[model samples]
Target: MLRFAGFELDQRRIELRAPGGEPIRLRPKSFDMLRLFAANAGRVVSKQELMEAIWPNIHVGEDSLFQCIREIRTALGDEGRQLIKVVSGRGYLFDAEVSGDPASFAASAGLSSASEQEGLAQQAGGHAAATVAGPAKKRQFSFGLRSRVAAVIAVLCAVIGFAVAAPMFAPGVVAPENTPTITVMPFVDGGSDPQATSMATNVTDRLADGLAKIDTIRVVTPRSDVTTASLANAPTRPADTDFVVSGELQRSANSWTLEARMTNAATGEVKWTTSVAVDTENTDLALQQSRLAAGVGHELAVRINAVLYPRAGVASPLTGSTKVVVEQALASINQTTRERFTAAQTMLESALANAPDNLDLQVTLSALQTRGIQMNWYSAAESTAAESAARSRLERALQAKPNYLPGLEAYCRFLTATNNFVESLVACAKVLSLDPWNGSALYQLGLTQIQLGRFDDALANFKQADRFDTPAVSRWTWLLGIGWANLLLGHSEEAVPWLQKSIAITPASGRPYMVLAVALQGSGRTDEAKAALAKAMVLRPGSTALNVAPPKRNASPVFLEAGQRFIRTLVELGLPAG
Candidate 1:
C-alpha cells in the first residue's frame, strides 16, 4: 500500500481509493503510470523512462504516453496536472509526499526485486526504466487467511490515513523552483449583459496566451471539467501554482474597463494590480475586442515578468541584503543629484567591500559609476578612469553571470554611450530573448535602432516599450525616442504630444525640450518654439549647433540630410550659432 496526499494505492488488489473509502477507478496502464509517479514522488521522471515502463515490449509514440498521463491526472482529481507537472522541454515531475505500509505487502504480492526490475529495464529498448508493473503472481488464499490479511490492511490504512490527513490541516506551503507558475482565472463580468461575459472570457484567454510566450513562466490550464464542488473545496495553494490572476471586466455604453490583479496563491497576498479603460465606439467590434485584450495582456505580461524575472536572465530569489542594496542604488540614480549620486556610489562601495563576490552589487556599482561619468560629475581624466574601472568590473560580473539582466542592461547602455551600436543591439536582443516583456531592453533596442538610422523599426520598438511599461510612466526615454523618431520623419505634429508627455514625466532633462523646440519650429509655432528653446538653453547651458554632434548611425545621405535640417531648425529657434 502506498499513501500520498489523501489517496492510497493497494498493490495486492491493484486498486486505488480516495480518503472516503470510495474506490477511484483507473485504467490498467494509468494505474501503472500512477504507481511509478507515487514511487518516485517529488522527483522528475523522464518521458523516455515513463514510456519504457508502461509499454515495455512494444514500440509506441509519445501521444500514447501523454494520454496515459492525462488519464492518471483525471483519476487523481489533479487540477492543472499539479501532482504530475510537465516540466517544459524536460520531463514530468510528480510533486507530492509519499509514505506507506511497506512490510509484507511486497513479499506477499511477490513483486519484482531490484534485480528483476533491472532486467525488465534491459528489455525495454535499452532505456533507463521505471517500475510501474504489478506483481506477476497471484496466490490463492484460504478464507481464514483472507480474514487475517483484511484486518492487517485495515490497521495499516488507518495509520496511513492520519499520515496523509495531517497535512490537510497544516499551513499551506508553495515550493517553486527556477520557473514561476501562474494560473489565469476567467475574468468575471461586472456588468449585467451576457455579451460582457464572452468579452471577459476572451480577455482571460488572450492574457494566458500572452503570458505563455515567456519561456521562464509556466501557465496552468484550468480544467474545463472542474465542477462547482471542486472549486468550493479547492486547495488553498491550488496544487503547485504560485500565482493566481483574477479580476473583473465592466462595460458601459461605448467604453469598457478591465481590471486585473495577481495574488500569491499560498499566502493569498496581492502582488500587483492595474486597471485600463478603452473606448470602442469608433472602432470595429472585432478590432476593439482584440485591441483591448492585447493591451491588457501585454500590460499583465510586463508586470508579471518584472516581478518574476525582474532582471534579464536572472532568476529572482534575492537575499535580503542584496535586494536592499539594489533598491537603494536605483533610488539614488533616480534622485539625479550630484550629492545622491556620490552617496549611492559610497553605499555600493561599502557594501561591495564586505561582499566583493556579490554580482548584484558589483553590476549596480558599475552602472552607477558609468552614469556618473556620463553626467560629467567627475573631471575628464577622472571620468576616463571611472569608465575603465566600471567596464572592467562589468566584464567580470558578466563573466560570472552572463545572462544577468541588470548587467546586460547596464552593458547595453554603456555600449550605446560609447558608440558601440552594433554590440549594444546584440546584447539588448539577448536580454529580450530571456524576457520579452522587459521594457528596458526594448528601450535600449529602440535607441540602437535610432543610432542605426532605422527610424521605422525604432518607432515600433519604442511603441512596444510603451505597451509593456512596467512602472507605468517610469520610462521617459522611449517616449522621447518616439517623439524624436517622428520628428526625424517630418511628422512634427505627431511628435508634440509624445515629447510633451516625456517632459511632464521628466522635466529635469533638457533633451525633450530641445526636441520639442524643433517640433514647434517645424510646425511654424515660432513664438512657442523660441520659448521652448529658452527652457532648453537654461537646462543645458552652452548649447550650440556647432558643438552639437550629429548622430553617426546614418547608412545613407538621406538620414544625414535630415540631421542637418534639424540642426538648422534648432539654430533658427534661438540656439547659439557657435
Candidate 2:
C-alpha cells in the first residue's frame, strides 16, 4: 500500500481511493501492474521483468502491457505518467516515494519465516512419506493437501484488510520551496478571427511592459522570447521559462473573454488561473483597453509579489494632481500645430503651479519652450523671452536635484538650441559619465557631435545610442543620425541600409527617407533617389534640400562642406527648397 498526489492504492486488496474517499475500480492486470510499481518504488522496472512478475506462465502482447499502463494512469488522476515516467526504450520508472509497514503485515499474516517458506515443499514431502499408504492413494492425498493450501492462502488475504488500508492513512511528504520567476507568454486566439491573434499579442506586450516597470521583477520582452509559440505547441513543458503564463482569448459577440493559467515550467503544476471578460463595445475603446491592461498588470503583480515578497507594499505613485497634470500635458502635446505650443504652455503652467518642485514638469516645460525658439515659430522677442524663462527653470531644477538625468538632458538640449554647442557637449558628457547606458544622453552627445561637424565621433555615439535598450523613437533617431553621418563620410552604400532600417522601424517619420534620398543620389541611383525625395516631400512638405544655414558654433569647415554636398545631392534628387 502507498499514497501520493491525492491518490491511495492498496496492493493487497487491489483497492484505489480518490481524494474524496471514493473507490476507483480498475482491471485485474492494471491493479497488478500498479502494485509492482508501488512495491519497487524509485527503481526502473523493465517490461520483461514486469511481465514475468504479473504473468509467470502466460504470454502477453505489447498492446496489452500498454493498455494496462493506461488504465493505471487513469486510476491515478492522469498525473500524465509523471509519478511513473516511461523511459523511451528502457521500460518504466516510479520516481515518487512509497511507504508501508511490510514487516508488521508479514508478521500479522502468520506467514512462514524466509527459511521455512523455502523448505515448505521438502517438509510436506517428509509428512507424506510418514502417512504412507498404497502409491496411488499417497499421490491423491498429497494433491488434495496442495489444493487446501491454496484455499487457505485466499482466506488469509481477506482477513488482512488493515494491510490494504494503511497507505490510505499515511501522510504525504511536502515538496521543497521554489524561487519562482514568471514569464507571461503571448495569448492564443481560438476564434475564427485572425485579428484576435494580434490583439492577444498586443495585450501580452502591454502586460510585459507594465511589469517591466517594477524594479524587483525581471520581465523579458516578447520580441526576444518565443513563449507564444511554445504555448501553441502545448508540450509537457510548453515553455522553457521558469514559470509560464499562458492564456486563450475568444471573442463572443462584441466582447472578449480571456482564460489564463500560470504553471511551474518544470513540473507542469498549476499555481494560479483565472478568467476575465471585457466589453469591446464600450464607447471609448482606448479607455476600456487601458482599464483591462491595468487590471491584469495589477492583479498579476499582486499575486507574484505576495508569493515572493509578501511583506513588501505597493504604492500608487501616479494619482491625484500628478495623474491629472500628466494626462493634460500629454493631450496637449498631441494637438494640431496651430494649438500645440499654446496648449502645452498652458498645461505646463497649471502643472507647475500645483507641483512647484517637480523636476520632470520643469524640464518638460524647458524643452518645449526651447523647441518653440529653435523652430523660429515665435517672434524674436518672444523666442528670447521663452529661452530666458527656460534657462532659469532648468537652472533651478539642477540646483534642486543635481543628479536628475532628465533635467540634465533637457538643459543640454536648451543650450544646443541657443547655439551654445560647447556647453551642450559638456552637459551631455556629464550625463553619460553618470549613467553610461543612458540612451537620451547618448543621443544628445551624437546630435552635439553632428552640430560640431565631428562626423566620426557622431557616428560612434549614434551606434552607442542604438546599443542601449532604447525606446522605438530613440532607436529610430539614432539610426537616422548614423545614416546622415555615413553620407557625410561618403559611405553612401553603407548609409542606405541603416536609413532603410530606420524607415522600416518608423515609416511615418520623414527624416530617414530624406537622408536615404541623399545616399541614393550620391550612389548615382537618380530615379530611385527622386522617388525617395518625392516620398519625403509628401511626409514633410516644406523641408529643404539645401543646407543653407551656417553650421553651429565650433563646427569644422571641411565637415560643413561634406554636409552641403550631401544636401546638393538631395536638391538634384528634386526636394523642395524651403
Candidate with top TM-score is 1
- Report the lDDT tens digits of candidate 1 across residue range 287-392: 4555565556656665664675355444333477767987889876633656778888998899888777777887788888866765556776887788788777
Measured on C-alpha atoms, candidate 1 has an lDDT of: 0.63
**Which lDDT value does model 2 have at 253?**
77
Clashes of each: 1, 0
RMSD values, in order shown: 19.6, 28.1
TM-score of each: 0.57, 0.43
lDDT of each: 0.63, 0.57
Local lDDT at 30 for model 2: 82
Candidate 1 residues lying further than 4 Å off, grouped into runs, are: 1-183, 218-220, 223-244, 250-325, 332-343, 369-383, 473-475, 550-561
116 Cα displacement, candidate 1 (Å) = 49
Q: Clashes in model 2: which pairs?
A: none
